[model samples]
Target: MTTLRRPEIGSTPEPLDLSFPAMPDRLGEVRRQLREWLSRCGIGADRAYDVVLAVSEACSNSVEHGYRHGGGLVRLSGVVTATQLLIKVTDHGEWKSRDEPSDPRRGRGLQLMAALVSDAVVTSDADGTEVEFRIPLDPRLSS
Candidate 1:
């Protein structure tokens, strides 16, 4: 279940947290909602679009491959500050490696996210997989 939070802007950035079941159908709505949030945070259209793509890809990977059986939780937490947009997507399930195939598009989400965000980190352990992205805030870049 996802929590409803009213993210606040102040001297210190207030983080917004949300969680949902690892279901394919829900990823799109969450991604769209996050993109809208980025815009509301004063991010540029291009940047927000890139963010949305990266986040969507990460979330998709979690929902589709994070567990071997049964569903788990996919959590998203974000904080928008005057100088940066920090976002994290975490899944509380076993991480499984994707088998290689002929198609190049099957396993390029991490690469794309690294290209889009200023800084990103992906870690997986026995507990879960966590992907964090930090995008530098540029005031004049917003549309």
Candidate 2:
């Protein structure tokens, strides 16, 4: 088993933390709960939805590829700055990038993530895979 360590962001970031079993059926609930959490915390609805979508994509990838639908853990954490919301999803599995025409169409999650979030980062090494997404959390949220 591999252990993944989550680095601490800067102090200017507000942290919202959550963890869930890597199950397909639970993904929707995760998104919904995150949405509510952000809303109650005074995050803008638009930015919250963007974060939810990006997180959903990342978690889905974990369920479909990281754990291969068997079982694993997905950790979702958010760091909100005055102008950005940084979300990180860590999975206890390795990432295998595909690069062939015949490659299973199973690798577009990152593409979708890139399109939905302001910034998307994937770090996969000996420890595990961690994907981070950022959403602008400017004064719009406090409006």
Candidate 3:
């Protein structure tokens, strides 16, 4: 389990940094820890939900698509400023191209992420794939 440092109210919290094995079972733990960290940072439940959902999709993508043969690591990190929250989910696996045929019912993770956040970007290379999300903060929460 990853330990998160609680932040003082009305102050920018320390950047969130967590790394775990890229396995399906670990996602629940990741979501739990992330929710706790966001709550401690004073993020409202509604906004926190959006962040959590988006990040979860990214992690799911890393686990499902990033690693095709064996297990790897997924790193989830974030920073909160007065204006917005920035998050990155990274996996150390070969990048998978969308040009390849994918499940018809799936592949909407990117779209879901985009709808939930102000900005969502994905980048990949031989080393890995990273999905970054930027979600604007609510005025009341940033104060």
Tens-digit per-residue lDDT, 3-31, candidate 3? 12323456776789999998999999999
lDDT of 2 by residue, 16-116 (tens): 78788888998888898788766655655665666678789988887766887378788888765556556788998765556535357556778778877
On TM-score, the stronger of 1 and 2 is: 1
Task: Write down the worst ten-residue block by lDDT for model 1.
Answer: 1-10
Model 1 scores a C-alpha lDDT of 0.74
Taking all chains together, each candidate's TM-score versus the true structure is 0.80, 0.77, 0.87
Residue 64 alpha-carbon offset, candidate 3, angstroms: 0.8
Predicted candidate 1 versus true structure: per-residue lDDT over 19-67, tens digit per residue = 9889988887798779767756756566677888888888888887785
Q: Which ten residues in a row have the lowest lDDT in candidate 3?
A: 1-10
lDDT against the true structure, per candidate, is 0.74, 0.69, 0.80
State the displacement of the C-alpha of residue 81, model 1, in Å, after optimal TM-score superposition: 1.5
lDDT top scorer: 3
- Model 1: runs farther than 4 Å from truth? 1-14, 98-105, 139-143
**Model 3, residue 11: what's the lDDT?**
71
Please, what's the RMSD in Å of model 1?
6.0
Judged by TM-score, which candidate is best?
Answer: 3
